[model samples]
Target: MENLELSEGKEGLPYNLLAEKLVLGSILTIPQAIVLASEKLPIEAFYLQSHQIIYKALLLLYAEGKTIDYINLITWLQDNGLLMQIGGTQVLLDLLSQLNQSSNLEEYIALIYEKYIRRALIKLGEEMIESGYLTKIPLETIFTKLERKFFLIAEEKPMKYLVSVEEGLHQILQEIEEGLKLPQVPGLKTTFTDFDFMIQGFQKSDLVIIAGRPSMGKTAFAFTIARNVARNHGMGVIFFSLEMTRQQLLYRLLASEVEIPNTRLRSSKIKRTEWIKINAIINNLSELKFYIDDTPNLSIGEIKLKIKTLGIELSKQIGLVVIDYLQLLEGLKSTDNRVQEISKITRALKKLARELNLPIIVLSQLSRNVESRINKRPMLSDLRESGCISFSLTERTFESILSTRNSILSWNGSSLIREKITHFRITGRKPTYKVQTSLGWSLLISSHHKILTKKGWKRIDKLTLADLICFKLILLSHNKFSITWDKILKITYQDLVPVYDLEISQFSNYLTNHLIIHNSIEQDADIVIMLYRDEYYNKNTVEKDIIEIIVAKHRNGPVGSTKLKFDPKYLRFFNLKDSMKIV
Candidate 1:
């Protein structure tokens, strides 16, 4: 037998024979080896011999499009009398994976030049020493030059930002000018009414956190979003579903996108019609750009590397990334507490968003405290682990928060708007039953300051008692305030004159002047106002719940309701016009 050189795996000396074979065969690319052993190899297992064979086989198979199936691979090795091979087919499989997932060839080259090239040169120097061909002095000079080149690439290349400074300013202006423009792609819409109004729809490079308690459609929502981005916008989307397998995620996506109902899809029960629907939808989906990876217990670094590769493969046209949830993600480095791990994870995600220039939608789990509350509406403070992740890295953090909150409230435009915009005191010192805005006004309180009037202070209840009664009737009779005065009073002038002190003339003036009721004269007359709901009143109390005008924040005009008629459903608060016919 020809003697094969072997060295004991030792402290400083490499397994020279394996390194020589690797360099001579050109079997393994640096990226292939790095990717393969990055996760699986133990500290002691990642030796020169093990990685060498793994890299070479993968490089060959990837380049040639040949496959080494399990049985065939085993038999071939046995025929080569290498059945006892230490770095067997398992190692080779990892190598093949790296090749399949090869993205960022430039980055890989840079990484290789930095990490392995010098080491390769060092190995070459050692070989020179052994072979007695080249001297040690020239090797050192070559190694130094190579090291300089590595640092030059590292220092010169700037990592991509989420938005370039000029582009960021332009984007902010565009967001302000257009509010949130829908993607130019047609037929895409958002399910959440409030979110739709606020964002128009999701934008690229946005790191949106959609968190809820378990089984609150986190995965389902992400799947919906991914489908929308991929199918509608013709944008590439990568979903890293750590909790579910690729097939399971694909099934959920197919069910959601095609409206097959999750149960039918999961049970594999398909009628002829349903199968036709699935086939047609699948064919449509085939035209979309979508990818899924079901790598469980994936670390953040691994995810970043994968995304980087994906960005490269897609020619930097990656539109979105969806991580199922934050807490499930692991960090490359180990930490004692989960909070720290999550903090790291979030930071990495933010970095990934910046790096890839795509919207990264990460699902999160709110604490059980969310469930414990009587109302499960989520607040920004309720965000898990890292509170800072909720805030954007803009110069005006408070301004942006207030602006977004104000926008949501302005669109709501009801008794709820005031309550929604206010920061609630979550201190638990106050009664849980009581609701107050951070501005210290009770949501239950009527707009009029009645106690002062009873104390002989100057009356500020601009409307008389009869007008107040009519306003209450309008608020109670209709779910909205967008009804005309003629519809609201219903009773004739004869009925009003007998019991009430208010005249029709005075009532109209009070509505127009004091209450700020607006009208539309487009067709038949209609009325709209932002009066307090009947729920505000105690029913037993002497004081009735009344509408109040409180300004939040207005960019275009002065902030405040101006006592305009408003509809909670249509969410339109405006002056009554004769033309305010329902469209």
Candidate 2:
């Protein structure tokens, strides 16, 4: 009852007001005792309100390297107006009177932490049981949410100790010495020989992200790695199939293995010889320890639990984990928007990889920003920002307006009437799309490049006939301009050409060709792999069957590209060494 703040958390909350006081008293009594307490206990770990307040003041004084005696602490509290809130000097006097020798500071810190954990557990139980009455929340969601929380509490976290650098170096040296006795391949080996050599195998605790545009075969590529690593190394690989169902995924694998077309297998029109091959390969395929769960809209937390559960059930260590695509994975229910949700998802996946020591491959779609550039090849910048700029090839203009890099243009939403173009850039060759308006105007632009619309800025890829676009109206009578919206009539992809980007002195967007076009839009992925195929864009490319896997970001090794022969008939990727001449 004396320290009611500590004991008042719904009676029987399990708190030691005395332990909290002992720890705080040790810090206030023996200045050196804080050295251990600082590492072991945090301020809130103290249960008593007055103790937490007093501990906070002492820690502040210690951090500032000031004298942490009662005089300095009291002066600090009085100066900060916290001494009275914590019951003034009398509380400090009582703590000093009750505390034993500072030699017991470590145990006192441990006891304080133990009491805090107990209180947290009881509070958690109460919250969970009370939620049982909420009809609005789904039972499965509640369970998954609670499971993540409990896992985090029980997780083993390494504490920092004062070990010398020499001690760490010796352990690392020992590991290298042992590594030399093992096989040449350090991490798990894959089917792609060149890739393994460049990457030194998919190293453990690596979050490798594969990103590409639609129709680029990102999923097929990831499947290839998952299957190859699992089969070649004899280790379990778990695939989180968010987009495709389990059957659909395996069908592609089977088609690739038997050298038969997926269409032929699905229609049951396969030749008798092909059927024999399929039956022959089914047993070998089943023997490989590849696991798949086709759960749609799965959160990162659920994936963790599933992979861990499967690993335990099979009594195997999971070598590789694949998430079909980053965008599809669901995040926790919060007020965060799509961008923030995606950020959380990627961060959580990276953390999960480190926790499980499993190499994770997450597939992602490069943002539309990549389309505006003629290069079309995604830089780390394409993922930076979305929904900006229009690389209009047709360059249609009203009143035959003439403007150059330094030309002045109408500045929207600014006090100034016009702004000069500080600079311009020639974006590499890309297929431009033509958008026609009801006003008999047409402009060629990149497919995914965004332009200002009545609804706000939107990607051209999402535009339809119903949408209205912003355009400048030249007022010849007064030699001025006015802005208005016009309905979109037609849109089509045009031929490839170099695009232009302008830098306005004051704003990001500028008026071009009588249209108020908008301008502008980064990855934390450890390793990034991008997919590209010449045949997707060109009908008569010399290497029609080649798929280029670009190692965009390799944290531990050199970044480069490797060619894999794309067998479209079977939806398979074969190494160049095994395939026909690429040149």
Candidate 3:
């Protein structure tokens, strides 16, 4: 790790002149050495202008599949009319005479590469100093540029290659055996049972697309997955929100985690009791290793640089990356046609995912054409500026969608649901419900009723007192409004009696709802129960706000739809089971 010091001399900069000569001379003496030297050193490695020119000529000969001996080198340079510029035949003869042995070719190449990196650093330092003097440029921007330059220099490691197929196969088999012993093979899980099952958890080096129309809960869904990976699994997460500010994103996360309406938090309207709960939630969340970058109009290069910086700073690998929405990203190069630019952006993101060996969930917007169609569900064609499917879909499903010219009409209820299906074919059982219409969507319904009650009632399975309390707590925390004990009792009775074919009177022996409500702490019950009562009592005045999460594309999983109950008041999302826990 010797530093190549810069010397103040007439020659200008410090460089290993002997090393460059040895590299070129060895290549001339043994033409095969050119291949090895070329892999290690680029033409830029030569500091001397004449040496650079000679290396360029050698590259031209190498590329043309010509021999690189002294005769061919001189002939090529002369034929190209550039022999005299580099000191003519005498220079070539001098280099040939200086050739010692090809054994030290690697050392010469390394020395040249080391000098090249040092020169690059020096140049970078000058640029940074000049940039710092500019008042117009932001300090962070200048630092980012310098960081990228440093990263490029540091990333210049020697090229690697497999020695033999047998060695590669041996490594592969060992990895497979090691993977077999793990319980789940160690990957970032989405925390969704079926979805994780299909995708086998977000594998390393995967680019996942979660596309939908505006206000489709893409951000919420992505946040949920990010939260699970960071909080539950203790893995690091980096979320880049192009549309929303970092504070706004944090507000959403707080609302979801604290189970308090985001409106209340934003307005500073939380009650004393609720504030206590919020404090506890915040304490829990503080333990998570999550990072957020709300930089608008980020280029792929900047994203890479930021990721590298975070990985180094945190000393931990980033498990997941969520880009709030893709359409807002600026490409490396601007183009008049937005579609081509977006295509380039996606391709770069895919490469980044593989390079970083982490799953990148890129949120995307469906085209407005979806609104014009009979069915609003998104198809692959609706992906804004989509070029091709980057991952595999079922062959039959893909072909069916491709062959069918007419829009597919399917039944979800009495209403005929029309879907503008274009890329994926429908397989398996016919969809019972079209919960999500924006992308590859399907819904699942459950019929099993397993209630937890403390006291075993006659004709209906009963739950212990503890079971009842647990159920009540779950119900109270899941919704936005407080519920009366009477409502809880009625809902529980309805859930149990119908399945057991028992009459309502069979549960009359239990304490009345009024008595139970009086015993339970009023603060423990939120407004969600009251909202539920209002829904039935004053249906004409009830307002409902719902967010749909559509699985547009899953690289290693099935594409489908899953619904979560969203309470805009709390800015929270709850699973159907918890939302309807009593029922």
Highest-scoring model, TM-score: 2
Top-down lDDT ranking: 2, 3, 1
TM-scores, all candidates, are 0.39, 0.68, 0.58
Whose lDDT is greatest here? 2
Q: Give the local distance difference test score of model 3.
A: 0.58
Tens-digit per-residue lDDT, 1-583, candidate 1? 1233444345454343333333222223443433333333222222455444444334333333345343444454556555456366665444334332233332332332233434445565565455455365576545444443443333333233246789889987986666446443212333333223323355444556666555444576567667766775677788999888998777766765566666777787878777877888889888888889888776665666677688788785777788886777866355443443565566556656755666677777655544445544443324444321111111222243345543221111222122123221111111111112222322111112111112121112232322322122134433444321211121111110111111110011112111222111100101111122232333563323222322222212232232224333222223322312111
> What's the lDDT for candidate 2?
0.71
**In model 1, which regions exceed 4 Å deviation?**
1-194, 385-583
The per-prediction tally of clashing pairs is 24, 4, 25
lDDT for position 462 in model 1: 34
- Global Cα lDDT for candidate 1: 0.43
Instruction: For each candidate in the order shown, give its overall lDDT on alpha carbons.
Output: 0.43, 0.71, 0.58
Clash pairs, model 2 backbone = 374-428, 374-429, 383-522, 384-522
Error of 2 at 328 (Å): 1.9
Q: Write the per-residue lDDT of candidate 2 for residues 439-503, one digit (tens) a residue.
A: 77777676645677888666777787788887656454545545578998777655566755443
Task: Evaluate residue 576 in candidate 2 and report its C-alpha lDDT on the 0 to 100 scale.
Answer: 76
